[model samples]
Target: MPEFDLIVIGGGVSGITAAAYARRAGRNVVLLEAGDRLGGCCHTWHPVADFWLELGAHTAYNSYGALLALNPDTAFGNLIPRAKVGYHFLKAGKPQSPFGRVGFLEAALTLPFGLGKDKAGLDVETWFTRLLGRGNWQRLLAPAFAAVLSQAAGPYPAEWLFKRKQRIKAAPRKFTHAGGLQGWLTELATGLDVRLGQPVQTLSMADEGVRIVLAEGELSAREVVIAAPLDVAAGLLEHIVPELACRLRATVMAEIETHAVVVPAGKVKLPPVAGLIGGDDAYFSAVSRDYLAHPDWRGFAFHFKPGLLDGDARRRKMAAVLGCEPADFAYETAKTNRLPALTPASVALARELRSALADTPVRLVGNYLNGLSLGDAAVYAAQGG
Candidate 1:
């Protein structure tokens, strides 16, 4: 017999859940992670605040059935009441309604038509413009979506946005843990055979099964599941599975930087709203945190435009958004390449790749395989799709 029934690479949310499912199915599984911590992008920390600050994946909606199913006893932290919701559009350094008067009129006129019947060959920009009118699309929808996805909104397909709308409607209330998402992740990691900092250098097909080569040694497994990012997956499968690697290589990815800044209470009196969305050229589209949960806390979390702002520039953007000098607020930053540019071509290629890998023991599981939410990743990983 091989050393193990399955060897799962990557230790993010998807990988952890994948291993858990495999173990529950009576397979001896081992999970290997390149980083010291298990939750790749689902990180939480407390740098200078009394409450936990999320450096990575923060919230999960009720629609995350797969994640909830995996940890039935886990207690989620708090929920931001729907009535306390706030959204703003930042223009000329001032907050305005997301939809201006003209945009609102346009939305009223066109929203009746809905997102349209055809989603086959339409890009997000065109579909949104048609559904909400040009003014509304430009003023409200585009910037809000750009900030939410951490990438420009034009290239992606309309079907992705349609699915997102369905998810949002399905799960309206978003909840986070008291210790941030890390608390949930830590709970999930328990009772699992997870090895931290054990990065696999290469993978190949062996006569017995799949061979995983690590820096320290090599192991064989009857089955292998790759839950790593597409780029990393492509690199590992280059020689062993060129076709899969080529498909993965064709996937276009976007980089996003998340900043958590804590301002002193009463130092900067922001609008009573929970968050603000910026215009297309604005650095950040949204800024919010669990202000309602911790009434006295002045923490604000921000997501920036992909690949646009770096270290100093990001600091400056944060300062501007918070109406204070960068030195005034205690802040932390985490960069990730988790967002996939799900264009029409990219979506088609992903579907083709899934079909190609359907018969093999080797499987791919992550945000790209299903959708781009933590819930989607968990569902895809747990289902082994």
Candidate 2:
């Protein structure tokens, strides 16, 4: 007999949700994580005991029903509401209002004609361009959305980019956990069998069920769920499902070179705003801690185009943007944020892969299978996809 009924690989939003669900269903489950912590993209950096900043995914919304449902306390009261700050665009090296670039007449003209249009088989550029006119998409939306996705948003599947889901109206429309999103996710994983720093090396089928091979030893489970990054997932599934793994390898993973800094609030001349869209610059955006105020410290995470700048160069640029010097930074860190470069074709691929694995004991979930958002991954995993 298998030692466990289910084994979930990876510890991001997807794996956690899968483990949580299977555990609740009375299955003997254990979660395996490759990293020192969970919450793959819900990464938060704590520079001091009292202050923390988001280095990856910055905001959570009320429409994230799957995530909000995991909250174990008094509903919305426990969530921290973000101050109403807005994202801005950088023009001529100064912060500019997002609306400053909008072409009102162009949008007004296209809205009537683009209404009720179907989004099937379309990319974000095509759908939004048609809906808002080329000028508006070029001037106002393109760069703004790139900042949101931390990549070139043009090729993203229109349908998967954003979906309409029912909102938890009682919760703040945009909020984070008390210690930040990562802290909240840790709380959500409470009591579930989680083993951090346990990276699964490979998988195979045994008489009992699936065998999960790790660096040290191995374990057997009646079922296994893979919730790692695209390439990692592809490599793990290669020997088990050759064809499916080959197809997964065809998809590419996008990387964002993130450089972050924490500085005293007194040194910054940039006003209180959510973030800055890079637009044609060497980066996608600069996300700030302004959404949730800190008494003396302010932090920013600049998601830059890979290989565009070196460490010293990025530090100087970050200081230039923040209206301070590199020396003003009290703390600093760097990380590479990766996501699947998904397209309309990738959506079809997801469905195909899901169907192929249905009859097998191996299950898969992550940002690639669904949309890139944590909530989207949660919803997909909650559905046992």
Candidate 3:
């Protein structure tokens, strides 16, 4: 007999949600995480006992129905609401509102003809350029979208960009947990079996179920859910499903070199705002902790395109943007965040994979399937994909 009813090969939001769903259905399930902690891209760095900085994903929305449905409160009762702030762009080392860059006349002229265009099989650059004039796309939308995605954003699928979903009115529209996003996700995995520092090696279909291989030993489950990164998922599926594996392996991954710093509140000369969008600059975006004020400190995470700067240069650039020197930083941290480098073709690929795996015991879920938002992973996972 299988040792478990279900085995989730990953412990991020995707994996945890899968495990949670299995457990709720009264199945025996286990979650394996290679890292010491959960929350793959939702990393929160704490320099001191009370303060924390988001090194990865920074915000959550009420539209994340799958997550909220499984939430402890089931309503956003306990969630910490984010304070109001505006996202701005910087020019000549000064801050400017995002609207300042919009080409209103161009937008008015092109929007009418662009409204009825289908998003399917179209990239963000192509879709948006048609929807808004080239001037508006170049002047405002391009960089702003890049900042939100932490990558070029041009090749990303237009359909996967902003997935429409209903909201929970009682909950705050935008919020985070007291401990951080990581901690919030941890709470979501509260009753599930999550094993940290456990990396899966390979997956094979057993006579009765799926057999999972690890460096330490092996485990068996009637069903298997792969919620790992795009490349890692491809590797796991290599033996059991070669064709699907090949398709997934062909996908490229994008990297964001993120550097975050926390300084005394008084040290940062720039007034508190949500974050800054990098236009043609070295970085893509810089997120601030201004939405949730810290009495003694403030934090910022700058996501840069890889290969542009080394360690020292990155720190100097961050300091310059923060209106302070490196010496003013009380705490600092860095990490590389990777997401599927998707194209318009990916949307079709995701649908094809979903249809192919529908009748099988194997399952896959992650940001790559839908959108890159925290809600996206939860929704896809909740749907058993």
Q: What tens digits encode model 2's per-residue C-alpha lDDT throughout 1-385?
A: 8899999998888998988888778889999999999888889999888899899988999998987887887456779999999999887778899899989999999988887888878999999998999999998788998999999999999989779899989899999977798888888888899998998998999897899889999999999999898899999999877997898998988999999999999999899889999998889999999999998999999999999999999999999899999999999999999988899988898898898888889898998887999889999998777
Alpha carbon deviation, residue 161, candidate 3 (Å): 0.9
Work out the TM-score per prediction: 0.88, 0.98, 0.98
Candidate 2 residue pairs that clash: none
List clashing residue pairs in candidate 3: none
**What local lDDT score does residue 183 receive in model 3, on the 0 to 100 scale?**
91
TM-score of 3: 0.98
Point out where model 1 deviates above 4 Å.
74-83, 99-102, 108-116, 162-172, 291-296, 306-310, 334-338
Cα lDDT listed for each candidate: 0.72, 0.90, 0.90
What digit string (tens of lDDT, one per residue) describes model 3 on residues 68-127? Answer: 888888666679999999899987778899889888889999899999888999999999
> Superposing all C-alpha atoms, what RMSD in Å does each candidate have to the true structure?
3.1, 1.1, 1.0
At residue 334, what lDDT does model 1 achieve? 55
Q: Model 2 compared with the native: what TM-score? A: 0.98
Error of 3 at 339 (Å): 0.8
Residue-by-residue lDDT tens digits, candidate 1, 1-385 = 6899999999998898899889889999999999888778787767664666666665677777777667645443333323355678766777776545346677788888864468766788888887889877776777777766667887777776636423333333666655567777767768888898889899888877789999899988988889888788888878856886887788888766676777665555566556777565545544566434455556666666666777788777777876778777755555553567777776676677678767666888887776677887888899876
